[model samples]
Target: MDSTRTNKLLELLQTIGLQELNSSKLLSLVDEALIHVSAGRSKNFERLEFLGDAVLRLAATEFIDQQYPNLPVGRCSSLRAQLVSDRWLAQLGEQLQLESFLVLGPKALGDAAAQATLQADATEALIGAIYSGSGNNLEPIHHWLTPHWQQTTADVLARPHLFNGKTMLQEWSQAEGLGLPNYTTTEQSSRHGDPERFKSRVEVGSRLSANGFGRSRKEAEQNAATEAVQRLQDVGSEINSESPNNTPH
Candidate 1:
């Protein structure tokens, strides 16, 4: 790579706390990672992104195992899912200001709808590049991602319902012999980044239902589930309040 490009990559590494690994091959991988397919390059980040997907999962699994050893397997699985989710990756990319580093084509630059996906893909590819660049060692990945994962873990734990509302609702329905919750989603808008782009309604058996809206179908469904869970909790509270345990005595 030329001096200017090398300097830019170095700056990016430094920004992400990876300044020590400054070799040419590593820089090349980083360069590839930041290149979108729309850039019309023969070599893009697709392969590295694929590798990064697995690497990210392994890293998340390890993080959960070490940090929350006593956590049940099901919870661990859910936590890892959040840690490696596309939404999480896109957020990370935004935090790192990765858009400035990306080399995009005119189409990609003009298309705002795909921006989040691009950021997510680029972030995953960057992780793969770091792993490959360091001789397949995961130490760098752990060092870089541990803090982020820790914060995310704490947040998820604090608002457990917000992070895994769908799962929690499903489990609640099954335990109550209510069968699985059913969800129906409809697209409400064609605008990218519209908070109410999709509307979702979730029903539990025949008596309980809630509606929610979000930028995507998954988010909309999750919101609906969250509301439904709240309604169920309210019903439980009401039943307890009406019980004869302490009636007017």
Candidate 2:
């Protein structure tokens, strides 16, 4: 490992209130150019990326537990999904300029900044690297990520349906082997902020499951999706309660 590069990487950690026990390893995590796009580089962060995905989820879960101790498990899962989402991770990487530290192959370097997935994946790998460098001590990872999670959590909590409803609904549909839910909207009024300007209906297969009215088309769709998500949760809860695990002798 280059002493100067390792020192610089450690300094980067300090800026974010993180310390690394294995600076060299952490350096490789942010080196996404090599990990994702480099053809022949045997030394890459692909393994760390896998580890980071799990680490990120664990960190988000811990954050929810600490911040919303009274929140139900289902709601907590939703919040954790928001915090650890690709969009949120990409935003964090951009905020930290993680791409600047990348060691890219020629092909990956040209348009690196615009590749959101690359950025998000690199950030997760970096988290994994941080955990590794901390000798499996989670404190460094938590310290570094908690602030980001705090801000993200607040945003998601404020806009619950907007943040995760549609995405979760899609995932739920696929998981349930129902293909994809279809959403269609109709104009209800010729006005903005009318609270009934548009109405969106969500259909599962051929059945109309839920609908919602809102000021705008997007808002209406979000409202409809939110209703669907709530309905799915209710159904899931009912199923769980009826299961053997929840049955009372």
RMSD of each: 7.1, 10.8
How much is 99 displaced in model 2, in angstroms? 1.0
TM-score of each: 0.86, 0.63
**Model 1 over residues 28-57: C-alpha lDDT tens digits?**
999999999889999999999999999999
Model 2 Cα RMSD, 1 decimal = 10.8
Best by TM-score: 1
Candidate 2: tens digits of C-alpha lDDT, residues 1-249: 477756667666767876535455556554432255453577666888888999889888887777677777876776777788776787888887776666667666565334666677778888887777667778887788887777776666455545666766776677667888898999987743356678999887853378988756776887898788777666653111110111111
Clashes of 1: 0
Q: lDDT of each structure?
A: 0.85, 0.69
Best by lDDT: 1
Worst 10 residues of 2 by lDDT: 239-248
